[model samples]
Target: MNFYTVLEYIGMFLVFVGALFLFLGALGIFRLPDVYNRLQAGTKATTLGAFGAIIGIGLMRPEWLPKAILIAVFILMTNPISSHALARASYRRGIKLWDRSVVDRYGPYLREKEEKEGKR
Candidate 1:
């Protein structure tokens, strides 16, 4: 019936959704066939989940908004970059993809780079 009450409800909903995403991410990590797929699921889902949870907390506590926003921004920036780096390292170290993977755009590029470096 009031603005603060509405915000509290919304915040609770977001926190719940965020928790769900986190649970799904964990499940995906365990269920996926390969490291790449697991990384993808963990990174993307957890990033959104953390964002949602942090923003919900911020909404529920206005005084904590700035810190929450900072943390959210940090997670947003780092999660994907770290995941990509890990994937690339795994690929470079000869990690195999899942059997059902369709395409590999990085293969040719890495090969070419390796060749160029070898020639140098």
Candidate 2:
């Protein structure tokens, strides 16, 4: 097959994979036990899914590649930041984690900061 045709096939495959990730992300949001876990699902998976779809679109329409890549980069940069902000807000607001959650690195950090400030 020609180069463009091969690219089209790859684009189609990416789109399919992106859609699957999107579906799984949605399912995880609903099925996950806590807000943090849901946010994890929503941000990480959806970000990847969106990136895949955008890149796939770029592949299929070569002229649109630059814009698609720009959008993908924007998403990549923002998604995790937004998710972190949301999680931090939730934590500060005293939202409890799932009973089985194993780690809480943030709590200690926050407490240390507070102690330092109080001592000042």
lDDT of 2 by residue, 55-104 (tens): 99999999999999999999999999999999989999999999999988
Error of 2 at 24 (Å): 0.8
lDDT for model 1, please.
0.91
Positional deviation of residue 77's Cα in model 2 after best superposition, in angstroms: 1.0
Candidate 1 lDDT over residue span 24-106, tens digit each: 89999999999999998999899999999998998888789899999999999999999989998999999988889999888
In candidate 1, which residue pairs clash? none
The 10-residue segment with the lowest total lDDT in model 1 = 2-11
The TM-score obtained by model 2 is 0.90
Give the total clashing residue pairs for model 1: 0
Clashes of 2: 0
Highest lDDT: give the candidate number: 2
